[model samples]
Target: MIQLYYAPGNANLAPHMLLEELGVPHELILVDRDNHVHRGAAYRKLNPNGLIPVLIDGDLVLYETAAICLHLADTHPEAGLVPPLGSAERAHCYKWLMHLTNTVQAEMITYFYPERMVDDAAAGAQVKAHAEARLAQMFDLIDAELAGGGPYLLGAQFSVVDPYLFMLARWSRMMVRPARNRPALGQYLERMAARPAVVRAFAAEGIAAPFC
Candidate 1:
């Protein structure tokens, strides 16, 4: 069976939800992140970047959350977590997934770990504040897109991008202007949170309510 290395509420969330959505037999391996196990040599062998998520399938060891999501979607095409390849919908799916991981997730990293980007404690605070502001703009644009064409990012189809978006939005739950405050985006999150697959994933990870 497939095994997913994870820490609760970490980047592994999107893939975990996808696994549940796919109804595939999989094993969840806790990484003990709070004890810094992810930074250890063994974990580094699995993912040199020491990231929270790593997927092991047979002999393949995959890291990178977006890549894992795409792989799962591709391998389980019947589930339609992604659109048909070479189609416009598939292209759009790629677009949104890229935007979520490359753009939004990067900014979130800065917001949560500003010290990595700056020299002093004061500078870290400034970096975090600026990152939060940028995240707001990013989410605002997403909200506008949802306002025009949602129920899902691709409009009616529940794609891999939706779970990725939900995971990122949940990271902002403590912000002054959280992602849930936006009208369309807030509704989108509620819909995602209500999904049986999403609920199962959260429960398996021991994540409680106020999910977004």
Candidate 2:
């Protein structure tokens, strides 16, 4: 069985949701980030960076949300969380996944928790403004993508992309300029939030409903 060390209401929610979606047998260990549980010596042994969403599967241990999501998808191809290699759609999935992790996720971190990235309040505010603008643009792009009548990111078929996109969309609400204006994106969020896997993830973490 796999063991996932995570915290509620954090980026770790992405992998937690993915694990739930996959129906994988795993142990969920709650780490108290506020209390510095991740910073402890023992916890650091698992992940020197002190990040949440650390997955321990037998002798293998992994960190980073994107890497964890992809690993689970690859390990369980029957779950259909990812597309197979060499397919056009697979390329598209990889493209968006990278974009979400490198672009949208990074911008969100800067805007949502500027203190972690910079010390100057004025500089932080400026950077946050830029991030907010980029977020708005990204939300518009997502809305357009889903506007093609998607019950999921890649149309009718759901994959790990949905969970990853859902996580980023949820983070958008925390931004200074929320994505509430995008009706399609807003409705998409509602659908993802209603998924049983997502519900269980929030409940497990003792967090309120994400869409609520």
Candidate 3:
């Protein structure tokens, strides 16, 4: 069985939701971030970086949300979390997955939790403003992508991309001005929030429903 060491209300929720969606049997091990449980010797032995969402599959251990999602999808093709390699759709999947991790996830982390990257408040604010502007632009791009669509990032079929987007969209609400003004984004958030897997993930963390 796969063992996932993670913290609720963090980026780890993305892969946790994916596992739930795939109906894959796994153990959810909650880590206490506030108390620095991840920094302890036991966890560092698993992941030197001491990050949450450390997936242990027998002798193999994985970190990083995007990597974990891709690994799980590839391992369990029937789950349909990702498109198979060489397929045209797979190209889009890889593209957006990278964008979500490097672009969307990067800016949000800088803006919402600047202390993680820097200590000076003035410097943090400047960095956060830059991130916020970039996030607004990205949200617009995502909105345009869905303008002609019904649901999901890549149109009809859902995949691993959904959970990543859902996690970022949830974080957007924490921004000074929420992205709710963007109609497509708002609709997409609604769709993802309605998913049973997403709901269960939030519940497991003892968090209130998405977007309050």
Candidate 4:
């Protein structure tokens, strides 16, 4: 059985969703952020970064949201969460996955924790403003991607990449202009919300519906 240590609505949401989609039996270990358990030595042993998510599958241990998502999808090819190996769609999956993590999610992290990016705490607000602007532009690109044709990111087929996208866009809820405010992204988000996978995951996470 796979076990995932997570805090509600954290970066772990992507993997949690994928796990539900895969219909694989899994255990959720709460890293109790409200009590700072994630920073505790036990959790740190699993992830030195003190991140909210740490996936443990027998002898294998993994952190980082995108890596976990890709692993789950690729390993469960029968679920069609990821495109076939060496195919054009597979290439597109990798491309968008990287961009979602390194670009969009990165900006949101910086946007939320600007003090980490600046020498002085006073500059944090400016850093946050700049990051939010970048996020707006990023969401615009995501909207464009959806507009470029299909219902899903990589055209007609839905992949694990969609949940990753949905989770990030969900984080955008606090933004001045969230992804749901964008036409294409709004419709896309609606579609994702309707999925049984999403419903189960959100319920498990204890997050109330009307999800972003």
TM-score of 3: 0.93
Whole-structure CA lDDT of model 2 = 0.84
Clashes of each: 0, 0, 0, 0
lDDT per residue as tens, model 1, 1-212 = 99999999999999999999999999999999879999999999999999889999999999999999999998998988888879999899989999999999999999999999977878999999999999999999999999999899999999989999999999999999999999999999999999999999999999999798
- Top candidate on TM-score is 1
Model 3 poorest 10 in a row by lDDT: 203-212
Residue runs of model 1 more than 4 Å from their true location after superposition = none
| lDDT digits (tens) for residues 5-92 of candidate 3 | 8787787888888988988888889899889999999999888988787998888899988999988898889877777779998999
Q: In angstroms, how far off is 163's CA in candidate 4?
A: 0.7
Instruction: Spell out the clash pairs found in candidate 3.
Output: none
Per-residue lDDT over 73-186 for candidate 2, one digit per residue giving the tens place of the 0 to 100 score: 999899888777899889988988898899888888787776666778668777778778988998899899888869787777788778888878777776665765688888
lDDT of 4 at 63: 94
In candidate 2, residue 16 scores what lDDT?
88
lDDT score at residue 154, model 1, on the 0-100 scale: 96
Name the candidate that leads on lDDT. 1
